[model samples]
Target: MTIKEKINKFISEKKITHAEIGRGLNTSQQNVSRILGESGKVSLDFVVWLACEYPEIDLEKLIRDSDHVSIVRESPATYQKPRLKEKALEEIGAVLDKYM
Candidate 1:
């Protein structure tokens, strides 16, 4: 399944509403609705933010489409800090604080 489909499925399976996700992500309900809308294209940064916010969700599964093979990296982990826009940084930090 595509990332968008996965998000929709996750929402349904968890019985989560857009307002709830918006509260967690520190965004408006309308923004969350827009993000999950039929034509919405989830960005990598947004996926990362979602993972950080809802750690219970399998991020790898959410990110990987069914048609693609999952690659396992044997190399040591490297921390490349994400460069998010100001608004995104604020929202991510707020969401993280709530969970952490």
Candidate 2:
């Protein structure tokens, strides 16, 4: 599933309303709806946070979609940093484990 699809699915599964997620993430409810339905664009970290929070969610697919949205589920965490090397980051993610 794409990132958007994963987010939508997760939101539905979690029974989280758009307004509720927006409130939790400090975003707009309309924006949240637009994002999941492919009516907007968001940053990469937001999508990454979604993947990290909802490990079962498929973010790769969502980000690759034509809509280009990176936002996912309504987890309270945030993406703090990005590394240059994929291997290094992968190792870090593995070591950190929680955000992987």
Candidate 3:
């Protein structure tokens, strides 16, 4: 199934309204309706936000149009902090320190 089809199926199965989705994403109900509507183009940023908000939905597999969409949660121990993010945080801290 296509991503839109999968998303539509998910919405139907979950009995979730567009307003609820909009609330979760901090967007308008109209915007959600547009996104879910036929011929509506789904953006990468929208997909990322949707995935982050609704962890239950396996968007990656849906994007690939995989038949089996499963949620695989990695352990915190298995998660590694990115050095770039660390450096950015350090830089922000330095800036704040300088200002304060």
Candidate 4:
């Protein structure tokens, strides 16, 4: 299913009017109507906002749109913090030292 189609289906299931969804997303009701009806496109940012807003919504289904998925990753690099704060440093160090 396309992304728009998925959203439309969910909207149907939720029995929510476009106005309500738009209100939740801080957009106009007519714009929401256009988005649902394929008269306008829903931006990736909007999709992200929707996902963040409705955490319980099935993302796999909700994000399935005709438009290609837009994955916005913050960063790929790893960051490290002292495990002492997590109180697992000793346990972690023991495992790592064993492997080494």
Model 3 — which ten-residue stretch has the worst lDDT? 71-80
lDDT of 2 by residue, 1-100 (tens): 4645656666787787888867756889987787777766554555554554455443333544445343442454343334223433453355445443
Runs in model 4 deviating more than 4 A are 64-100
* Top TM-score model: 3
- TM-score of every candidate relative to the true structure: 0.57, 0.47, 0.59, 0.55
Positional deviation of residue 7's Cα in model 2 after best superposition, in angstroms: 1.4
lDDT assessment of candidate 1: 0.60
lDDT of 4 by residue, 2-81 (tens): 76766676667667787877788888998888776757787755665555544444443344333433322234313233
Q: Which run of 10 residues does model 1 get worst, by summed lDDT?
A: 68-77
Q: Give one digit per residue, the lDDT tens place, for model 1 in 1-100.
A: 6778777776777677888887877888898888889877776566766555444555444444445332222343233345334434554566556555
Q: Could you give me the TM-score of model 4 versus the true structure?
A: 0.55
Candidate numbers sorted by TM-score from highest down: 3, 1, 4, 2
Query: Each candidate: what lDDT?
Result: 0.60, 0.54, 0.60, 0.55
**Model 2: lowest-lDDT 10 consecutive positions:** 79-88
lDDT of 3 by residue, 1-84 (tens): 676777777777777789988887789999988988997877655655555555544434455535753332232223233443
Total residue pair clashes for candidate 3: 0
